[model samples]
Target chain A: MLKIDNLSVKYQDGNQVLRGLSLSIENGETVGLIGANGAGKSTLLMTLVGILLPLEGTIEIDGLLQDKKNLRELRERIGVVFQNPDDQLFMSSVYDDIAFGLRNYGMSEENIKHKIDYIMKELGVEKLQNMSSHKLSGGEKRIIAIATILVMEPSVIVFDEPSSFLDPKTRRRLIHLLRNVPMTKLIATHDLDMALELCDRVIVLKDGQVYAQGNAKDILTNQKLLEEAGLELPFCLQRIEL
Target chain B: MSEIKKSINRISNLEELTYRDTVIHRLPPVIKLLMTVIFLVTVISFGSEQVSGLFPFLLYPVLLMTVAEIPMRPLLTRLLIALPFTLFAGLSNMFFSKEAAMMLGGIIITKGMLVFVSILIKTILSVMSVLILVSTTSMNDLLYAMLYLHIPTIIVLQIMMTFRYLSVLAGEISVMYHAYILRAPREKGIKLIDMGPFLGQLIIRSFDRADRIYHAMKCRGFEGGVIFSEHKKVRTTHWLGLMIVSVVLLILRFVNLSELIGQLVIG
Candidate 1:
């Protein structure tokens, strides 16, 4: 399980971004975090992954307290997929990018290759193993970015806008893939329809606080709660005047 | 301006060429890198008046180009980009050093003219050789070879990150330029008055983007060390290739193969 309790993050100017937010995700659960702009969804995800040092709070990953001593292991266990695949996929080739994290852990090259091949195969991106990351189509790059994280064998996978730039077909494929990934997933996205399809639970953030949380179907379908959180109903849930 | 777009495309093309699988591309980066250094030093060591001596070194770039299958047009295009500086330097020698070295077919061949030709040849060979090395070896392999040879990690990372972000930086500039042009279609490029603010904004934007990239890298366990998971070890064949190339370049530098061949034919 992954846990964040009373987490607070502040910028250098001392403006708090995540305001004492607290949440916990059980093992093998997929949770969708939805919010409008400035709702602190991305900030929360960044803080959870240790990018933003929380001013006050605790983060525990699988019974491991997140301190400077164990931060490396915590990072290895919780993979983050950034909004831009270009930023995360820094290596020259897709294979190298995927192998980067594994190399940091000092895994033998033979084991690294095996693990990468397995992950790419699982993701159905075997052809992309040797291709340059920069050359990939946006959708392909997104999938490969996921592959890079998945190869690390993180216990929990965190995604920030996984389906933002994808076409409808690619979006469907990604949703399908995420649905089958059996691990804890924290996806922060504005794509409510995707959240509805892939998430078991959903949390809505407003003004850097969790305004609503419950079963995915109930919270996403609750029109009043979503409106108060500065979001519209998911496309599938909205009633058309026609 | 289209300058950013052209530059982005050129970088993309050169990087793409590195992905090809060929004999030259398969050569170990360390050996290839060593050969390039030796080739460059040998090419530059030639005295300005020894124009004929530099002629033989042309074989290295020419052979690599042919064997690596790098198209000539782009290669020469990049070569021409470096030509002007050397051209200026060589042109000055034309006026200052005008002692006639020999008579060729009843025409005066001045030492200064020889120096000029020698400088031109040196520029072409050096640029072409470096381009070939970059085109044939992927950036990761080259950087890894540098690390293997104990080049400071800081310098390699600086060079690598600068290269990796060039595309991102170019994309941002292209967007900024597009927005500027849209707002000021009457002007060509940024107005001189606007350049200050324009560049200032770019610097700020670059810092913001750099912060994000650094965060992403750190999240992936970057600890100031380059983690290259994919590397081909330097093997015996690579060592042999290095030795052979070095011997050949050195022999050409001193033995004057042309002179010896001409003597043999005449005798």
Candidate 2:
């Protein structure tokens, strides 16, 4: 469904973040991208959405290349949930935020309203339909952020740090939601346990390169590989088997 | 901390009031916006010495507020914040112009005082009318009205994004203020020496936030232009309300209602 070939991204001041990294994900697969801070996970996500032009290499989404000419169409097929819900939820009300993409696509108001109602109800945020973004709690904001993406009905969804700042119950709910979503999901997170619970495959990133890639359970259990990538084993797997 | 919280609450309270169901709230946003513009123009067009002429204009806001079922306290509080600048301008007129314009029971009313009062009345009436429009109409509706009026899409988007960012920026500033106070409990506010770094940090943080927001917007397929759904047609009642209110405003603008009432009562 998605392909990246020798992708290398750099900042304006000559700081290379992602260097010659290449990977591909098949349709209907869940992949987790895990690494320490500044692992280029965000850069990769932004590049895929055409927000940041990669320095070298090509990104193809459903056979459409990521470029200025194809950005609008490419973005239509990909939904992104930003790390900070504040950034994603820019509309005055939750309903508007969820309907933003639909409006951009020129959907009828009736259709937009129907989709928004269904999405908000599915996320159990119906009561917050009219609430302002800033007034919501962290968990509520996160759920609303997800709804904003989900309402777009994109074929692929990219999530950046979806579990951060959420309480345990809300975290569990998120895990459940991510596990059940049938679309192609590329989640970048530090929550190893969540990745283990939701991702079918795991890709470990270290210093702008793919250090390791394998099945989610196997990659997660490799303590030596994780430590080398500046990560740690999930808490549940931290102890040695007696 | 309390001050910041109060200001945040003040904004949300005003926003909440817009959702209340009432006749005025149900009026089309374009109509309310047009009424506000017409009211402001009429209030400002009066002669600088015609304070009594402006007195009748207060009815517009008062009637709208009553019908809208909006409380006056929040609107008045916001108006108070805007008064000082106008008050200062009026005070300058008091000091500069001293020609006597009227007499009442041996007391002189200078032309300066008349102008001052007129300015004050104009400020109050204009601000209150806008407050009524805002309190009764949601920001979403107002933006739609702007789009319906054929305002440029970029300008409308700028307004919407700026308003959304205002509270976000304010919340950030509030947190920074609390952190400052917590560290230097002996100080009232950031010291003048600290203002450089204090404000610098805010700008940097705001820039970073804006960058992320731009990326988020782009990811949602925002491509410079915004599309709005078709607006509802302006109805008969809207036309009638506009005509009646406008005619009354014109008559009051030309003929002082307060003087006519006094003449009839005291004759």
lDDT string, candidate 1, A118-170, tens digits? 88888888998767677789999999888888888899999999998899999
State the iRMSD of every prediction, in order shown. Answer: 2.0, 1.8
Candidate 2 chain B: minimum summed lDDT over ten consecutive residues — where? B224-233
Q: Cα lDDT for residue A197, model 1?
A: 89
Q: What share of the true interface contacts does each candidate keep?
A: 0.57, 0.69
Q: How does the DockQ of candidate 1 come out?
A: 0.58
Docking class of 1: medium
Model 2, stretches more than 4 Å misplaced? Answer: A240-242, B95-98, B150-154, B227-230
The regions of model 1 sitting more than 4 angstroms off are: B263-267
> Model 1: per-residue lDDT, tens digit, B1-267?
388878867876787798788899888788888889999998888887887777778788888989999999888999999999999999998898889899978999887888889899999999999999999988888888888889999999898889888877887788899999999999988899999999898888888778887877777787778766467778987898788988888889998876677689988
Clashing pairs in 2: none
User: What's the lDDT of the predicted structure labeled candidate 2?
Assistant: 0.88
Query: Residue B74 in model 2: shift from native, Å?
Result: 1.1
Give the CA lDDT, 0 to 100, for residue B199 in model 1. Answer: 89
**TM-score, every prediction:** 0.94, 0.93
